[model samples]
Target: MTQTAKQAGHILIVDDNTDILIAAKLLLKKYYQKVHTTDNPFDIEEIVKTQPIDVILLDMNFSQDAISGKEGFYWLKKVVEQDPSIAVLLMTAYGDIQLAVDAIKAGAADFVAKPWQNDQLLGAVAAAYAHAQDKQKVGQLTRQTQGLNQALNQGAGGKNFDFLGQSAAMQQVFSTIEKAALTDANILITGESGTGKELAAHAIHQASLRRENALISLDMGAIADNLFESELFGHKKGAFTDAKADKVGRFELANEGSLFLDELGNLPLSQQTTLLAALQNRQVTPVGGNKAIDVNIRLICATNDNLQQAVDEGRFRQDLLYRINTIEIRLPPLRERSEDIPLLVNYYLEHFCHKYKRTLSVSDTDLQTLSAYAWPGNVRELAHAIERAVILSEGELLDISTVVGQVTTTAQPSQADSAQSESDQLVNADTFNLEELEHRTVRAALKHYQGNVSQAAKALGLTRGAMYRRLEKYDL
Candidate 1:
């Protein structure tokens, strides 16, 4: 039978017998690229320290006079202390089988009899090598999983929300959430559209003491002015035109839990007055009902618009804002925290790759371009981009060109102009031809650097040679 040599593995064999060492070396040489042999148990530590050893095959009886396996036991403990990941296999004569089994309990991976068969020895070695490799892989995966979970736990809680950031801005937000979690006060989350305000509200709910209960969410924008009172407070049967049966509102459902009121700034004046009354009284009076119901609930409100500005315009109630803003958490725009782009991109890339079962890797250059682009839609937009890229990816690595192609057509021209312009210009479809505009922008970058290729290349996130070739193709 032909034996397949295990590639790129190092094995250490420690035995007191010179004949056994020679025989084992000859047999193991075919399986491993590097094999180190030591006849003295004391030299095992030195060999491990100087060499990259994956597995240690130690003999149970190291000394002729000492048959109690004391030397092997002592060395086994030392080897494990030095590197916990190293796999160890113990060997003993047929009479000393009990001693070999005891060594296994002391951390040895497996045991082999002294009169070992070739297949048995080879199988043990192969299994030990595989086990060690698996340990290393699991360790790496554990670290990555912990990192992602910690990041998610630190962000605002909500359904299917992704915590996307590694920037100082995000760090500050995380620290604020950690501090806010210690209190039981009402929280107000403020941010621009698509800034994950709802997510932050969810985070507060998850981190709060009342997390066991449900987190009921109500979109103030989605509730009609006529249905506002019934939505905030439950209604008895025959309350309105659509009322066929008694219904429970968000306030009642979120009793002892968190009530997330999204787009709070959009709530009509009439609803705000009723909401303020409910907050101050710690109770609710259902529409078309005379009885008052007492409830204990934590209120968390989120909004993209400025409530203070709305209050000035007499559109939003100031008293309601004060009640909700007892503690406020503001999420900065993705452009303000550009450092988090790559981390968020990788997070979404991994998520989508797994979702699609695709093997895809992002190149450093592709990541740079993604980081430079201003994500108007924030983390949500970036996730969509990565998902699209994963779907379009043809090979082992994601093709940036394919991503760019999809992005160029759907991407608003104003967004690209806003990214390139010195001022904050809103990008709309009326701005420019995206393909021609992208080509022109690249040409402008090349001209600005005076053909000082590297500088121009850096501005456009392209290699110097690649930029020069593109310039030639465009006839610039």
Candidate 2:
């Protein structure tokens, strides 16, 4: 095969015979990206250290009548000690078959005798290069898996309420997850931004047959447009400007496990086709890599958007939606299941109290007040609110003000104030100063949304930037 048709690598040749070094370099350089030869056996370590050598060709007899091959064995040990993953090919002038068998037993990849045919030399080098690549890839995979497992454990620590609810809505969700976890079907979880979609994914993976394997989670919305392919399918070294090393993609890392794609609805239509193709084919070809790697994964996707509506608007691919939604599960928002609020609140309260080493209690009145409020941001907002309350509390009672900020009377005006409409109440303030009224209105909007700037801005008919400016102007 031609050089372009073959899988190329970096070759290092170390031999005391200058003629042998010259001949090997001339022949191998035609097929490999790099071929470095040295006549001094002592320079092996320096050369290997400086270059990304995939395979090393060492002379079995460095000195004349050095047929015992002790020098070759010494250099071979040095090479292996430097990197056990590197392949070392032993070459000798003495054609001793027993010596070849001995070299194989001593960690040498292969042994080549002198007067070797050109084709035989090329085949041996190619085999050694392939061995080195395989060994390096396996090492990288093991390290990556360990790192991924560590992250997964840290993330799981916060998911204590994965199945902590007693409401009918949550019970149904648990039932569906239990049934789906038994099969190898693709699952799509639809919920508001903070309804615990990621936790649901974790629950499914933990209960499934692939629980022992990795559960790779990727936030689709967080990835940049240019990096979508490389992040999901992986990239080889030198594939792009920033690709300095080979990457194992989420799909490959989650092989025979689960791959959770969060915020999948935020993915643009242009990139949806690429993801769809990989799912349909069960294979991913890394950037700058010629061969395709097969992946066996159970797909789990979560999104806050109404994907069917997105498909109707031509913003999301219909086929892709169909592929991911083989088994759909929708989580009810906090507002929809108001009764479950107390359970979530108590859970987070205990969790935060233990975490912060504080003693705090929530009264029934406070629980009622919390349940009555419409939590637009859902469970995630409530979680932050409780944690904020715990950390900022100095007394035995949980400080609700620190959690939700100052509550404006606009949400629940007194009987006398109820007679006046919201706009009338604002206009009839003691002072008609526009500045004072504007500040009060801004503060109220912020408190009503529980500090959600976007929702507050939308409620007051202002853009996000305009809202930010107002907050800056009022210093609120």
Candidate 3:
């Protein structure tokens, strides 16, 4: 690497001889941005705590005629204990093969002999700095992965869903996602609602070179326009009324990994301008901060809306579309891939059966019934149907009677028709208990929509959370 390229690294030299310390710092400072030196080993801890030192060069002997390398071993342990990611190189004039092996075994990064050639010393320091950087990246990636996993589990209720398909249309999607994962180019996934767009994003991330790092996914449709900049670029403490503390934005959190932005077409023209600038510059400035932070993330965006139509209609920016869609992956809706329905149904059935602790088997007739239905909610709808069936059906052979309903309506019907139908169905009820009435209503809604939660919630004038609560409260 060029000296300018290595300017971000910091080096520390610890030696008993002032001459050695000065010479080393003078030569290294020209290449590295920061160079520290101290003769007393006692000051190592304080320097380490205060400065972001990437590599340390230490002398094995601290006293005259001292060559056993015991002092070097002691400080090496101390430095590593303080920060395991920092690389430490041990040096001694009386070095031997045994001492080198011992130093390495004691956590020293490398061994250097005293009176080393200038080129040799520089190469050692450079190698040590690179090692430190790798360790730092690994450590940061681990912490970010843990945080992202926790966030996903909490937000998605720990749903474990994967893309499963064998039809022609789906094979094409799989091919495109695989090709996209081989590069760092930005990707745009387009499909109808509930067509597993997010699942495609996850597949790309898992297959990509950045798989070891966290894949940060955000729903662009859920972000309010006013909070768009603060959410994507972050904000400092006291930046605004609700800015309680310094927050890292999604872009920063996804550095050196992948950032999946769902519902990109829902982004307004005004906010598109800000997002465009960040992607173009590869950096983001916090709301109240002047310095911009550089980020390296593979961009993956999904949208059900027609971005091309939106751009032509003057809703989306043409330049932003060009920036995001270096590669476009269009997922076929469930209806277009009906041949894969049986496979999806069986997978979900097995999963939900295991989850709900039931021994059940689906009949060929039931599978055929499911395969024929027009699933407006796609695979998500199919999975929910199977889960509900597993929970509600009794006595073996998978009762899908509750999963089949009349002509599927994408939206809620008029209030008159809904109330009249509900009343007629309730006219034969045996009890007047409010709880019992609510349970029956929830069950009917689920049945009417074939286990589609969003539609059922809308039909009952309840949020999805309320619908879920009813399902759990009555164990239906």
Instruction: State every prediction's TM-score relative to the real structure.
Output: 0.53, 0.65, 0.60
Candidate 3: worst-modelled 10 consecutive residues by lDDT: 407-416
- Of the pair 1 and 3, which is ahead by lDDT? 3
Model 2 weakest 10-residue run by lDDT = 413-422
Q: Sorted by TM-score, highest first, which candidate order results?
A: 2, 3, 1
lDDT tens digits, residues 1-476, model 1?
24664556789999988888899889988878889998888887777656768888898776554567776778889988876668998877744667766878899888888878888898898889888777755643453354335434554334675665778998898888878865778999887655677778777877888898767787776665888878778776666788986666667677777888987876768778988999999988678654455678888888766779789989889888889998888899787887888888788788888899997889897787787765555665566668888998787987766544423323233433644552222233246766666665664563344323345567888754466566545434
lDDT of each: 0.73, 0.80, 0.80
lDDT of 3 by residue, 65-131 (tens): 4868888988999998877889999998886999999999998889999888888888888889889
Off by over 4 Å in 3: 1-153, 156-159, 406-476
Of models 1 and 2, which has the larger TM-score? 2
Clashing pairs in 1: 156-199, 156-200, 156-203, 157-202, 157-203, 414-427
**Cα deviation in Å at residue 18, candidate 2?**
25
Tell me model 1's lDDT, rounded to 2 decimals: 0.73
- Prediction 2 TM-score vs. true: 0.65
